[model samples]
Target: MKFFQIRALAASVLLAGGLAAAHAQPAQPARTAVRGTIDQVSPTSVEVTARNGTKSTIALPADVRVAAVSIAKLTDIKPDSYVGTAAVPQADGTLKALEVHVFAASLRGMGEGFRPWEGADGKKGSMTNGTVGSVVTTSGTTMKVKYKEGEKTVVVPPDVPVVYLEPGDATLMKVGAPALIFAQKGDGGALKALNVIIGKDGTIPPM
Candidate 1:
């Protein structure tokens, strides 16, 4: 299959309620996001060393999809774009965005909802994945995002890092490169990668 087809399949399968919204049923395999640096790479698998020095060797699928998480401007976020933002709650009840990631069209609505996230400021934050209903640019960039369950109002500051996914190839999987692998643990105690998000030009993916 082609890259776009594979990417669509990946969005439907890998992110099908696997991001902790509802509990997985008995048939769904447990999913995990592995953040680490590439230690080794081979035709079949790649070894990743985590920040704490733990290493994991995960097998790659035949058509492993790779996407480049490149930097974007705050203006890139507009109405109807599917986006995910990590933000901390302000005293006035609005969320302050720490980082914003614009999902590709194929992966839109993949993980649509709000959930708790570990903030960059060491405080408890929130992750909102939804469609932008509206955007206002007065004091700060404010967005009202709507999802299946509910909606959230987020204020994106000027200094927040914004990123978007673009088509990428295996050449980004070189040794010592940072990667975020979405994998499913097999019953045999091994992990198989569903897809990978790699940074472009040293811009690490925040989510």
Candidate 2:
């Protein structure tokens, strides 16, 4: 082959190899939410007891973010407010909320959709994160939440936990408080904490 032809062929071969290598790289694991109580907390790690009684120890990174999910009233969720709720389908196809977390203005559009989630009961649940379109209060509170894809009408009982996220620190990691820790499992099965939402004064994180 001519000199120029040989050079071109070599460049193409190198490009193909690079593309193959890129395709072979494994995708990173997605983070999953862990709803449990903090059993122990150290400077480096945290031990949690899942609602089902299983124990998990997740590494706490130096920069791990902590937020307090404090108790709120159902009336706090107003029109156009962003919120997320975990609910289960009821007999009449309406959703019954297990817990609701009102997001701050900065987090308005985060996780805006409805997806399958696990409730406190450890059974099939759906999480809806969206803007509140309307709120009706009669015997109980009902909210019509709208998201990018769709909307859902959720029935919120008076006794269900309603909470909102606020700035928190490591001091909220005290034992016996209900916490929802978000952690990612590595390929080797070790879990590392990402963010944590803890409840204060006997409150439990609803989301």
Candidate 3:
């Protein structure tokens, strides 16, 4: 009787240890989906704009992969195009993204040549014809162009039409005619043709 009782106690202890080990295991994380536009993207974070016009920022894992949509329905996307949702991988290799999809249209040409004439000295001034060094802003009706002098950055307003040229046409425009650009003073100021013709070759370097 003593031997049998000792054996039963040992078996019970073994079963309890097994149950404790199982309970100590971590629970699986739930999958989620998120949708939004690419507001800002960096090596570690991606900013997106949602359908409700709200912005959502997400952190990127070290193993994150970036790819463009190749389907016809997604052809409207351009390089650096805003994307909605992206799958995030779990430690166990499962993928998940919330149901949200982000959307953003390129506003490349919406604002091309508007400038703020008022300077820090409270005097109104104008930016003259010069080489475009870089684009400071590429969204909405405002674009800031940095000139070669680099002394000041000029604010371009939304008067002159911004056109995206094909590679062939871009070359032609650079060689053919001069493009006219209007100058303005203050924010949303009056626009007047500053240069009758600026060489069409005026292109801002890549940012």
| Top-scoring candidate (TM-score) | 1
**Per-prediction TM-score to the true structure, in the order listed:** 0.76, 0.75, 0.24
lDDT of 3 by residue, 111-206 (tens): 233233322223333322222333333531211233234322333332222222221212222222222222222233322211111122333110
Per lDDT, the best of the predicted structures is 1
- Per-residue C-alpha lDDT of model 1 across residues 176-195, encoded as one tens digit per residue: 77788888889886999988
What are the RMSD figures for all models against the true structure?
A: 7.8, 15.7, 30.8
Give candidate 2 regions above 4 Å deviation: 1-33, 50-54, 90-93
Question: Residue 190 CA error for candidate 3 (Å)?
Answer: 46
lDDT, residue 143, model 3? 18
* lDDT computed for candidate 2: 0.77
Off by over 4 Å in 1: 1-30, 119-123
Give the range where candidate 1 is weakest over 10 consecutive residues by summed lDDT.
Answer: 1-10
Cα lDDT for residue 12, model 1? Answer: 20
- Point out the higher-scoring one by lDDT: 1 or 2: 1
